[model samples]
Target: MTDIETRIEQIAQVIGQFDDAQVPRNIRTSSKEAVEQWLLNKNKEMDLRLGMTASIMDEIFNDSNLPIHFGPMCLQVQTVLETLLNEVRGS
Candidate 1:
């Protein structure tokens, strides 16, 4: 895989952490959908995919039902995604 694809995979792995049963159903489902629909959707441009995924991560972070600990984790993933997006755009 290319560096960008590898970074996206890493972000998806981080998002996967929210898939546990302990997380709210909607949050878990949304996280999964973000990875499947945004991050892994190869049909989209890499920068567009990263931007969309970051947007979804931001929404997931803002969700009231999200666990407190997950907020920072989501932010971290979003930050990484945004950074990757910027790099992709720069190239």
Candidate 2:
């Protein structure tokens, strides 16, 4: 598989580890907001090819009422996204 596809699969694996009751409500909201903000900032620097990826991420992060169990997965996804963003920024 391609690198992006591989990363997306890895993220799905991480997300599959949790259930809806494991995360706290507050954490879910915070994580979503954090990811949304990060994506917004990164969107400015992303190439056209990555725009669809960013839009998908934005859709995921835009949900303010995601299950509490999703918090950890969100953080993991955030880490992966941050790494990707940093790469895009050449940091």
Candidate 3:
């Protein structure tokens, strides 16, 4: 991955460990922002995944009558990420 992506992941990981037990305002808010950005990226990734899944599912379904489809993981992640992004942006 690129340097910027690596840094963002690192920052997100640090945010994962953050708790509001310390400074409940400034540091907490910073950590929250880090997490929100990470979630937004995940949401973008999920869009890509959903498109791929749809194409693959179309091919597979046409080839076989068996029931097969992508799980709801991508949709679930997207929903969570969107909610988090909205919350962050609203803040």
Residue lDDT tens for model 2, 1-91: 7565466455544544432455555544443443344333444444332344344444555566655555455555666765765675673
Q: What is each predicted model's overall lDDT from 0 to 1?
A: 0.89, 0.49, 0.40
* Pairs with steric clashes in candidate 2: 23-68
TM-score per candidate: 0.95, 0.40, 0.29
lDDT order, best first, reads: 1, 2, 3
What 10-residue stretch in candidate 2 is worst by lDDT? 44-53
Where in model 3 is the C-alpha error above 4 Å? 38-91
Q: Model 1 compared with the native: what TM-score?
A: 0.95
What digit string (tens of lDDT, one per residue) describes model 1 on residues 1-91?
9987887888889899999877999999989999999899999888878888888888888889998988889989988998898898898
Name the candidate that leads on TM-score: 1
Model 1 worst lDDT run, 10 consecutive residues: 3-12
lDDT of 1 at 28: 94
Residue pairs with clashing backbones, model 1: none
Query: What's the CA error at residue 15 for candidate 2, in Å?
Result: 5.1
